[model samples]
Structure formats: C-alpha cells, structure tokens
Target: MARWGWASFLLRRLTGTFVVVVLLSVGVFGLLYLAPGSIQQTLLGTRPATPETIAAIQARYHLNDPVAVQYLRWLGGAVSGDLGVSIRTGMPVSGMLGGRLSLTLALTGYGTLLAALVGIPLGIVGALRQGRTADRLVVTAGVVGLSAPPFAAGLLLLVVFTGDLGWFPGYGAGEGFADTLWHLTLPAVALAAGAVGLLIRFTRAALVRELDQDYVVFARARGLGAPLVLWYAMRNSLVPILTATGLIVTGMLVGTVLVEVTFALPGLGSLLVDSVTFKDVPVVQALALLLTLLIAAVNLLVDLGYSAVDPRVRLGGRTS
Candidate 1:
C-alpha cells in the first residue's frame, strides 16, 4: 500500500509539472506573437529589408509558420536541448543560461544556508523561552527582519560597507571563490533576513502547540530533563516550520530577481530583466521556462520532504 501510494504521488507530481511546462511554453510563445511588429522586421530592421531577405530570414527561423506551428517547432527544439537562438545576440539560449546559472545558484545557496542557520536557532530560542525576555528579543528581531526589504537592505549595506567604510565590492560577481563569497554576503543577507523572520515566527508558533500536546505532558511526568523534553518537543514542532520554510525558499527564488538587478549581478534574474528590456525573446522565454521548472521541482521536493518530517502527514496524504 505504501509503495502504491508513493507511486501515485510521484505520478501526480510528474503530471502537474508537465502541464505547467506546457502552459508556460504556450504563454511565452504567445507573448512573442502578441508583441508589436513582425518578428522578421523587428530583427532585420528597416535598413532596406528586401522581400527576398525577409523570406530567407522567415524560413531560417520558421517565422512564416502559423503560431501553433511555431510553438510546436520551439517546443520540439526545447525537448532536444535547443532553446533557439537569441533574437538580440544571435547566440544559443542554452549557452547564455549555462554561463549565468551558476552565479544565481550560488547566491540562492548561500542565502538559504544563512536563513536556515539564523532562523532555526532563533525559532528554537523563541519557542523554548516563550513569554520571557529572550522571546521578546527574538520576536522584535523577527519583526525587523520581516519588515526589511531586500533592495533597501542591499542599498544600506552598499552605503555602509562600500560607500562609507570602503569594504567589499559594491556590485558584480567577483572572481575567485573567496571574493565571490565576499560579494555575495550583503545580497544574501538582504534576501534571507525576511526568511529568518518567517522561520522564527513559524517555529515559535508550531513549537508552542507541540509543547502543549499530551505526549509532552507524558514526557514531563516521566521525569525527562528539560533538555530532553525540549529536543523531543522540537522534533514534532518542526513539521509546520518545515512547511513554512519551504514556502519562504520558493518565494526567495522570485524575490531575488529585483535584488539581483539592483546589484548588477550576472545571475539568471539579471539576465532575464536585461533580456526582456532588450526584447530578447528567446532568452526571456528560456529563462522563464527554466524558472518555472525550478519552482515546480522545489515544490515537489518540499512535498516529499513533508512525509519524512511528519509521519502524520504521510499517513494523511495516503489516506486522502
């Protein structure tokens, strides 16, 4: 039964991912079609564009094809690892993404690590010391973190660390691992601050509930030490915290776009914004597709993770 249930869940996730991919592809292609002017004319410009040259360009790019046909052609190319040539740079979309994907991945990785490192502990402290001085301090810090905007945080850091103190690079992904980390520190902190706040709030709330459960009382009655009680209680409380953390991480993926642009970092978010402004359709489409896939994958992973954190969730999912 467990095996069958797991299989069913996997199948459902796969199906949903496929549907989302198709919809995203259609939407991106539709945007290109709906954009002003002809695709061929837009690319070749008005520098004496002959019909012969226009026809040749259309034939080269399948622009003469119907909208559905063009979409299918693009979809077919996408399946075969061809994301189409960039309308602006005449470079392969995959090449462009491959070059910048690492920077974005590094930023997200560092930011998420910082968030978890800071958030989990603060949450634990808040939960353990509920209604005390420590709790109040944690809550106040969480509120501040939640209220801080990533761009504002980034700008402030830039002013203090770069402008005033003359420490760290103001913008750009610096060369070398050490330099890159130094460059990423401020942006990652800015991005993760809110996540830390959210995690603390979630953890405190969840742990408070768990601490009041009958099993917690049983543990206390059995003469368990405060440390043991806290540990056991926290393990159960983490389920909801995990759920909220997953959501925060998902949001961070999109939220990092603005910060990336503001800092002029050579990440996927920056690339997407620049491409869109320049009307680089292929690049924009590919990035959008990749981001959609990434978000869907993250959500799927979070769903899978929930079962491991909470047996009740697994049983509930199976029964439902």
Candidate 2:
C-alpha cells in the first residue's frame, strides 16, 4: 500500500478506537453511579451516617454534583494524569496501580510466551502427522485444556505442584526477577492452558489448509526438504495464528483476575477485584479504562501485523 493509504487506515482505526474508549468510560461511570450506596457510606465505614457528616463528605468530594458533571470532572482529571484518590485507601489510584500493572504485564507476557512456544510446534507436528497417534494425543490434550476453566486448572496445578510435589511457590509476585518468575510459574501455566489449546487447534487447522494449497505441493514436488516446505507452509498460515495470539493475550490480560485471585498475586486483575468489592469508583474507572485502552492498542498492532505478514494484504485495497 502507498504511504497515504497506510496513514489513512491508521487514522480511521485510531478514531474508532478513541470513540470506543469514550463510550466504555461513560458506561463504567454510569454503572458506578447507579450502584447502591453512596461513596460517603463507604468512607464512613462503621460510623453513623449523620446528615452533617454526609454533607461534609459530599462537599469534600463533590459527590453531590450532577452525574454528568462528575463524569466530566473525572474525565478531565484522567486526561491530566490524575485518576483521583481511592476511597478505600485514600492513596492516588495511579500509585496503587503502578507496581501492580507491571506485575500483571509480566504474568501476561510470560504466559503468552509459554503458550506460543508449546502450541505452535505441537500444532505443526499434529498437522503433519494427521491421524497418527501423536496427532490424536495432541488433540486429546487440547480438548482437555479447553474443557478446564482457568480457576479449576489453577487449583489442580496448585494441588500437584505446591501441595504434593512441592515444586514451585504457590502465591505472590515474589521479590526479584528470578523469584518473581519462580512464583509466577504455576499461575502462568494455568493462565496459558486455554490459550495453548486454542492455538493448537487453530494452528493445526490453518496449516492443514495451507498444506493443501498448490504452492505447498509444488514446493514439495520440486525436491525441497520436508522442513523447508513446512516452513514455507507455516509462513503462509501465520495470519490466523497471529490473530489468535492477539486475542489470547488480550483475554489473558483481562481475565487474569481469577488466576491472580487464585494465586494471591497483587496484579491489576486482583486490584480490580478489590476495588470493585470496596466500591472504589476512581480506581475501578481507571483500571477499566486502562484495560479498554490495552485492547484497542493490541487490535491496532494486530492490524499492522497483518500487512507485515501477508504481502497481498494492502491497507486500503483488495489483497493483491
């Protein structure tokens, strides 16, 4: 595609993503507003909800303002890098999120890497073997992985690895890089199980289709080795794999709440759960917005990856 075409595509996608973020913010804010109980109630804890106390709390936090005005103020603050103080902790939401965000990102990164490393090769082997015993075994494993929920899988891992065998630490993000990796092992495996299953299935299907194409057959017929031919076929089949990977990574990031809770990890997912339980609207809003932004950014990267992987995929035109 031409430079102008690529730029136009990016502009359109960015504009659409921005609109989505705005709508998501509004929806989250509205839901919080409609939730039962006032922020003052949460702030007061066991203290009596006296009129003077309520009035003072309202004035202090502008809680009595119109819903639209409150949202606007919050949005303006977010734009200025101020996500407001947490009602539960009385600390800046950004500060509370900083370290936790890094931990979550690390968990997601490690899980995704593990999934890709295991899934892609197994898929290729399964596809090449077709109906052989190895293929059947891979298929069965994939089915089992897909059938099990992350929490269930996590518990199973916890039982076997932490309870019986005593292999890895059961919880926490740990202290340093090596310790963190050690602690994250089981959680990452549990988090990646479903993704691995999906990738195995997707990769096998894509490779099967690619191998049936005339180009693959011709390449093999030309006396190219099996490895070279398979390599070429894999390249041709990458688009679907890339798409699945992006979705898997996003799901892992957003769905880490259960895994984090299971492992007692202090990540964004756990933070989100805590914020919701405590009715900390500012923290909840900020986290929700951050997740939405992450999804949008990943989608944009996937679109760009499409053009990179497939030469025929032009930005603003039919595949050439």
lDDT of 1: 0.83
Give the top-scoring candidate (lDDT).
2
Score each candidate by Cα lDDT: 0.83, 0.86
- Over 1-320, each residue of candidate 2 has an lDDT whose tens digit, in order, gives 46666677668777888898899889866756576776678655556899998998788768878878988987888878888788788899889988688999999999999999998888998999999999999998888877878888899999999999999899888898899999999999998899999899999999999999999889888999998998889998999999989998898988699999999999999999998887777788889888888888888888778777875554655554
For candidate 1, the per-residue lDDT at 164 reads 96
Q: Residue 122 of model 1: what lDDT?
A: 92
Please list all clashing residue pairs in model 2, or write none if there are none.
none
Candidate 2 residue spans exceeding 4 A from truth = 38-47
Q: Which pairs, if any, clash in model 1? A: none
After superposing candidate 1, which stretches have Cα over 4 Å from the reference? 41-50, 315-320
